[model samples]
Target: MTELPAGLHEFLSKAGWEGAEIDPIPGDASFRRYFRVRRPSGERAMLMHAPPPHEDPAPFLLVAQWLSNHGLRAPEILAQNPREGWVLTEDFGNDRMRDWLDENPDGEESAYAGAIDALVELHRQEPGPFSPYDMPTYLRETSLLTEWYAPAVGLDVDVSGYDAAWSEALEPMLARQKPGVTVLRDYHAENIMLLGDPRMGAPQGLIDFQDALVGHPAYDLVSLLQDARRDVSEDLERAMLSRYAGRAGANEHFEADYARLGAQRNAKIVGIFTRLYKRDGKPRYLDMIPRVWAAMERDLAHPALGPVADWFARNIPDDLRKSGGGTIK
Candidate 1:
C-alpha cells in the first residue's frame, strides 16, 4: 500500500493492533474507503479512510451519536481524527440484509420483514438536528436528472419544462405525507443488517444513514419498497406500505401521497441512472433504467398525481415508449 497518514500506523500499533494484520475491505458508496484492523486482544475494528479535504466525517459521527441516543444500534467512535478525517469504529459483523437475501433468494419476504421492522423502530424514535433528508434531496437528486437531457443525449431539454413540471407535481404531494419523522433517504437493501435479536427476534442494524431527513413518512417507504436494483413485487410492496402506515397512524391520504412520491422518486432515479452512464462512465446504472421506468410508469397511472400524469403522457418522448425506456433521442 502507499504511505498512510502520519500517525495512522503508529496509532493503531499503539492501540494494540499488530503490524501483520491489516486488510482492506470492500466499501459501500461514497468517497471514503474502509479497512479492518485486528487488535492483540483479537477484537476487530473498522478504520474509515477518508482523504482529508473532501469527505467530512463530522455529520456522520454526529448523526451516529444522535441515533444511538435514540436507542438504535450505531457504531461507537473508538478513535478519531477530526482534522485528517479518519475514525475507528466497532465492527457490528458482516451479515447485512441484502447479502443474506442474495445468498437465499427464496427468503426475501421473511428477511425483508426484519428490514422493515428496523425502519418502523427508527421512525418511532424522536427527532434530532441536521436533517440529512429534506428539500436538498429535491435540488441534489432532481438536478441529476436534468443533466441526462443535455445535448449528449441528443434531446435538448435545454428548457425548464422538467423543472417547473417536477416542482408542480411533487411539492403538493410531498406536503400531503404525514410529516415530522426521521426519514433515511437511502434505506434500501444494502444499508440494513438483519441482526436477529435474542429477546425481540429479527431486529435490524442500520448503516449509511448520514442522509436522514425530517420529512414525510412516505419517503422511507418509497426508499425501501421501490428499490431500483430489484423489484419488491406489487403485493409485498403494498403489504410493507400498509405496515408503515399502520405504525405511523397515517390515513388514506397518506397512502395516496406514497404512490405520488414513489412516482416522483423513481422519475428522478431514472434521470440519475442515465446521468451516471453519460457523465460518470458507469454503464451498470443504465441496466436499472427499465426497472425504474416501470415503477414510475406504475406511479404515473395513479389518480392522485393527475397533473404530472398529464404532463408525462404528453411530454415523455414518444420514442422512449417504443424503445422500452431508451433515451429520448
Candidate 2:
C-alpha cells in the first residue's frame, strides 16, 4: 500500500475514522489530493489534502457552507484541520456529469437542462461574501494567453493592443455584473456530480468551487456550456443558453456577455493549460487547448468582441491560432 501523508492517521483517528481503508482518487490541475476514506463500519467520506504554501482548504470550506446553506448539494464537512490542510467531507460518489454523459449519450439534453436549472437556482440566491470578479482580475486572466502561450509559440504579440481591445469590449459585460452574483468560476461538467434525476432542474453535487467569485451571472453559464474538458454540441449550447435566458429573465445583452466571457475564459484556459504542460510537466493538458481555441474562435465572432477579435486577427496569425500554440513542443 502507498504510504499516507504526515499526520494522516492522527487526523483520521480524531475524526473517528480510525483504521479506515483510504484509497487515492484522481486529482485535477491543482496541488490538492483526494482520498476515499472507507471506515471499518462501512461509512464513506472524502479526505482532501491541500498542502500549505500551495493550497488552502479555507475557501473550499467557506464556499461549501454557503452552497449548502443555499439549498445546493455541496458536500457536508464532517471534520477538518484547515491549518494542516486536511478535510473530511461526505462522499459525492463517482457519477460525474462528464463521465455519465459519455456513457449515456442519449441523456445529454436532460442532463444539460438540469445543469442549467441548477445555475438558475444559484443565481436566484443573494450574492456570497467574496471578492468581485472585476476588470483587473479578468484582464490578468486573459493576459495569460499572451504571457505563456505566445512565448511558447514564438509569436510576438502586441500586448498593449490586446489589453486595450479587451478593456473596450468587456465594458458592457462588466456593467451588467454590478452588484454581482456568486459566480462559481470553475462550474463545468467535470466539477458537477449527477446525484439525483437527470431530468430538468435535477440536483447536482457541486465541487471544485474554492475559487468562486462574485461576478456576472452569465459567467458560470458560459463556463458550463463552453466546457473545455469535453465537447458540448452547438445545438445543446444554444438550447441551454436560451433556457437560461428565458428562466433568468436575461435581457438583450446576455448573449453578448456570454460571448465576451466565453472568449475571455477560453483565452485564459489556453494559457493555463499551456503553463501546466510547459512548467508543471503535465503534458496531458495541452490536448485540451485545441478545443478551447475553437470555442474562443466562436466567441470572438460575436459583435461584442469586435475590438478583441480585431486584436487577435492582427497579432495572432491564422495558422498559429489554428494550432492553439500547443504543437510547439
Candidate 3:
C-alpha cells in the first residue's frame, strides 16, 4: 500500500474511526486516491483522499447528495472535511463491472443493459446545478490532442486547423444542451461497480463521477460503449445504441450526435492518456491510447465529423495515427 496522506488520522478521528484499519485502493488517472476503511465494530466505508491544489472534494459531495436524493446509487457520504479534501463515503464493496465481466463475458449484454437503463432514467430529469458542457470546453478538450499527443509523437501539425475543425464539428452538440442531463463524464466499465449479484438488474454503484457536468445525454453512452480500457464489441455497441435510442425516444439526429460526441471524447482521452505518460511520468496509461485512437478514428468516419476528419487527414499521417499509443519515439 502507498503511504497514507497527511491528516488522514485526524480526518478519520473526527469521523469516529480513530483506530480503524486503512487499506489502500488502487488510484486512477487523477491525483486522488482511495482507501477501504474498516472499523473495529465491523463497519466499513471508503476514504477518498483528494489532496488540495489539484482536487476538491466539494463537487463530489454535492453530486453525491444530488444523486442519492434522486434515488440513484452514488456512494453515500458518511463524513466530509472539504477544506482538507477528505470524504468518507459508503463502500460499495469490490465488484467492479470491468473485472466481473472479464470473468463472466456472457454477462456483457445484461450489464450494459442495466447501465443504459440507469442513463435513460437519469436523463429524464432536469440537469443539476453545474456548468454547461459548452463549445469552449469542447475545444479545450480536443486541443489536448495537439497540445500533448501530437507533439510527443513528433508531429508539428496545424493547431489552428485542428481547433477550427473541432469548432465546426462540435457546434451541433452544443446546440442540443438545453436542460441537459447530468453526464457522469467517466461512465465506463472500470468506474461502475456491481454491488450485489452480478446478474441482478441495476444493482450497480457509480464512482469517479465528481467531474460530472450537464451535457448531451449521448456523452456518457459514448464513454461506456467506446471504452478506452476495454473492448466493447461493435455488435454490442449497435444493440445498446438502439436500446438507448428506442427507450429514450431520441430524435432522428441522435446517431449523428452520438458519433460527434464519441469522436470529441476519444480525442480528449487520447490527449489525456498521452499527457499522463509524458507529463505525469505514468507510462501505464500509454497502453490504452491505441484503443482510444481506434475508437476516435471510427467516430471520425461519421458524416458529422467532416471538418475534423479532413483536418486529421491533412495533418496526422498514417504512421503517427497508427502508432499512437506507447511508441512515442
Candidate 4:
C-alpha cells in the first residue's frame, strides 16, 4: 500500500487510529478522494480527503450536521480537520441505489418510492443557509451550454442574444414557483444509499450534498426523476411526481415549474459534460450526453419551454442531437 500523506497519517495517528488499515476507495468526477479504514477493533469508517486549495470540507460538515439535526441520514462526522480537508465519517457500506438496482431490477419501484419519501421528508424541513436558486443563478448555469458545449461542437453562438433568450424564457418560470425549499442539487441514484431497512424507518443515506441550495421544491424532484446517469422509466417518473404532488399539495404551476427546471438543469449538464471532455480530458462523460439531451428534449416538449426550444433550434444543430461517438464531433 502507498504511504498516506504525512498530514493525514499524523491526523489519523493523533486520533487513535495509529495502526488501522487504510484502503483507498474509488472516487467520482470531483477532486475529493475517499478511503476505507479498518480499526484494530474491526470497526470501519470512511476517510474523506478533499484536498485543500481545490476542494473544501466545511460545507460537507455543515450540511451533514444540518441534515442530522433534521433527522435525516447524512454521514456522521467521526473526526474532522477542516483546514486539512480531512473528515472521517460513518461508512454507509457499498449498497448504493445504482448497484442495488443492477442486482434487483424489480425493486426499482420501491427504491424510487423510498427516495421520493426521503425527498418529501427533506422538503418538509426548514430551508438551509444557501442561496436561493433564483434568476441570476439560473441564467449563469444555463450559460454553460453556450459557453462550453457550443464551442466544442464548433457552433459560434452570439452570447448577448443567447443570454437574452434564456432570461426571457426562464424569468416567468422562476416567478411561478412557490417559496424555495432545501434543494439537494445532485440528488440522484448514484448519491443515494440504502442503509439497513426502510421498514424500520432508517432514512435513505444522502451524500455529495455540499452544493445544497434553497430552491424550488420541484428542483430536487426533477433531479431524481429525470436522472442524467440512469434511465428512470416514464411510468415511474409520473407516479413519483404524482406522489410528491399529492403529499406536498403542489400548486397548479408545479408541473410547468418542474419541466422548466428540468430543461434548465439538463442544459447546464450538457455543457458541463462537454467541458469535462474538452477541458478536463475525461471522455467517459461524453457517453452520457445523449441521455442528457434526450431528457432535455422531453422537458422542452412542455409548452413552458417554447422559447428555450426555439433558442435550441437556432443554436444546436440536427446532426448533433443523437447519441454515440458520432454525435459529439
Per-residue C-alpha lDDT of model 1 across residues 1-329, encoded as one tens digit per residue: 44455667866765556472677776433567778887657788888766567788887788788888988887888887756677788886787766777776777777666666667777787656755344556645665655664344565453366666666666765555334677767888777776663224566667787767677767778888889977689999988766766665777677667777787688678777776676667777777787887887777777777776676666557667445476533
Candidate 2 lDDT over 199-223, as tens digits, reads 6455789999999999999899889
Q: How does each model score on TM-score?
A: 0.87, 0.97, 0.97, 0.95
What's the lDDT for residue 23 in model 2?
94
Q: How many residue pairs collide in each prediction?
A: 3, 0, 0, 0
Regions more than 4 Å wrong, model 4: 1-3, 176-178, 197-202, 322-326
Query: Quick one: how many clashes does candidate 3 have?
Result: 0
* TM-score: model 2 vs. ground truth: 0.97
What are the root-mean-square deviations of the candidates from the true structure over C-alphas?
3.0, 1.4, 1.4, 1.9
Off by over 4 Å in 2: 200-202, 324-326
Candidate 3 stretches greater than 4 Å from native: 323-326
Backbone clashes in model 4, listed as residue pairs = none
Say which candidate scores most in lDDT: 2
- The models' CA-based lDDT, in order, is 0.70, 0.90, 0.88, 0.84
Model 3 lDDT on a 0 to 1 scale: 0.88
